[model samples]
Target: MGMIVPSLAHWLEASELLNGKGMFMTGTDTNVGKTWVGKQLIHTLRVLGREVIPRKPVESGWNADIQQTDAWQLANAAGLELDNSICPYRFSAAISPPRAAHLVGKHLTLQTLAATCPTRWDKRQFLYVEGAGGFYSPIADDGLNADLAQILGLPVVLVAENKLGCINHVLLAAEAIQQRRVPFAGVILNNRQSLPESMDNLNDLRAYLTVPVVTFPAT
Candidate 1:
C-alpha cells in the first residue's frame, strides 16, 4: 500500500531532504524510551553505512555528563563524534523544559532552537531530531514539543509506550499529528508486551488508524 499515514507525518517532502540529511524523532510522553529506540535505529542505520546525526532539540535533566543522556547514546550508537551541539537546550530539572528552565532562572525560546537547523550535518547523513516529552508536552512557556517538530519540517516518528491506557494517549497524539499537519511517521509500540491486550489493542489501532504501526519486540 501507499505510505502508512503515521509514516507520512514528519516525512521529508523531498527524498533529497533526507537522502543523506536527517530525520526528526519525537515521542508520546516523558520516559517513554525515545532515546532507547532512537539509539537502536541510529546504530542500525549507521551499520548500513549511512551518516546519521541524532539531536535532541531540547533536553532536560542533564547531569553534566555527556555520556549519560539520550543524545549521547545516539551519537555513540551512530558511531559519530560527540559534541554539545547535538542537543541545544539542556535543562537542570527533570521536568518539562518550560518548567525546568523556570526553576533554573532562564526562558527557553523556540527561536534559539530554530536557528540550529541550518547547519550542515553531512552531505548524505541522516539527521534524527529527538524531542523532549510528548506532543503536547510543554517546551517554552507558551508552547510544547509539537511546536518544535512543526518548526523542523521533518516527518516525525512517535514512540508510543504501550503502558496501560495507551490507546487513548496514542490516538490523541495521532489526532494532534493530523491537526498540526506535521508529517506523520507511524507509531512504535514501545514495550509491546507490557499491555495485557497489546495484540488486541494493536489490531484495534490498525483497523481505525490510517497509518501503519510496528511494535518492536525485545532483543
Candidate 2:
C-alpha cells in the first residue's frame, strides 16, 4: 500500500480547531511518534505563514553527538536555531527526565520546565510544546506531563501509535487530560508500521473520541 500522508485540508481543520495560542502535544506512550506528528504540524503551520515556537523543554535521551535529537528535530522543523530555550533540560541517559536528572545529581521542577516556554504570543505566533513520554510520565522532579499541560493551559493533542490496543491507550490518555481540565484539540494516530490492526485504529478512536482523529503516515 502507498504511504498515507495527512491531506492539507486535514491540517487546515486542525489549525482551525486548535485556534488558540498553541498546543501541548503528548502521546499515549513513549515512541508513539509524538515528534513525528509535531514536526508535520509545525511544518504545516509554517507553510500557513504562522510563526511556530517549538518547545520540547525537557528531553532525557539527549546525545550531543547526534544531530537528530528530538529538540533538534523540532527546531529544524520550525526553522529555528537549537537553543536552551527550546529544550532547557537535556540528559544523556535514555530514561525518564526525572530519573535522568537524578543520575546526574540534578533536579528539575515544574515551574522551571514551564518557564522555558515562550510567554509572549501573538496572532502570527503559534506555540507548539511537545511533552516528554506519555501524559502521565514524569517530566520533572515535581510533576508529570499532565501537570505541565495544565500549567501551560494550551489545548492538548494526543498522539498514539496506530496498532493493537491503541484505542485503549488513547482513551485512557484522553481521560487523564480531561480530568486535568485541559482543552483537548484532537488525536493523531501515527501509522508507523503496516500492522493489519493499524488500518482500523483511526475509526476505532473516532468512535470513542468526540474530538478530531487524524492519521499520520510513517516516516
Candidate 3:
C-alpha cells in the first residue's frame, strides 16, 4: 500500500509536533532495545484507548525465520500487516542503513523518506516513528537519524538500554538532540538484560538529564 494521508493540522503544527500525542523513537546506540521499548509503548497506548500507527522508517538485520525484517516484528506488535506504509525502506544486510541500501544499488534520501510518510492523517490518533541505528548513525548517504528526526519534526523519545556505560551514551545522545533544537519527549530506559550497573546507570541518567526517565523491566 502507498502512504496514507496524514493530518494536515499535524504537519502545520511544527512547534507542537509531539503536542498531539505522536512521538519519534530514537536511540543511544544500535542494539539498545529501541524496538523492545517501542513495542511495549505501542501496547500501553493501545490499552489507553489510543490508535497508534508505528513507523520504523529504515531497518536492517533481516530475520528470515519470522519473515524478512524488523518491520515484521513491529507490525505484529502493532497488530498491522507488514506493509511498506509502516517501513518505507527495508534492507537485508545486518549493517548500517546507508551501507545496506548501497548493496542493492538504491540510495535512501531524506526527501524520499519524508515523502513516504502518510500524506494525509485522518483517524489515526498517533504517529509513532522509530529511527534506525543511533542518533548520529548514518541512515542515508547524506543524512543521519538526527536529520530525519528534524525533517519529521516530532517530539523525540530517546530509548536507551540500561547497562554499564549507558549514562555516557544516553547523555551524549540527549545533548545531540538538544543541539539540533528538536523537541525532547523524555527517555525510556529498557532493561533488556540484567546488569549490576543497571540501577546506578539509571539513577545517574535521571540525575544528569532533566527530561523524564521511565524504566522497562527485563522481560
Question: For candidate 2, lDDT tens digit of each residue in 57-110?
Answer: 999888866577999999988898899889988999999999999999999999
Q: Higher TM-score: candidate 1 or 2? A: 2
User: RMSD for each model, in Å, please?
Assistant: 5.5, 3.3, 6.7
> Over all chains combined, what TM-score does candidate 3 have?
0.85
> Evaluated with lDDT, which candidate comes out highest?
2
Clashes of 2: 0
lDDT of 1 by residue, 12-115 (tens): 22222324456566777888888887776665555445677677766789868878877678778877676767777787788888888888788877767766
Per-model TM-score on C-alpha atoms: 0.82, 0.92, 0.85
TM-score of 1: 0.82
Off by over 4 Å in 1: 1-21, 119-123, 192-199
Better of 1 and 3 by lDDT: 3
Candidate 3, position 123, lDDT: 50
Candidate 2 positional error at 37, Å: 1.1
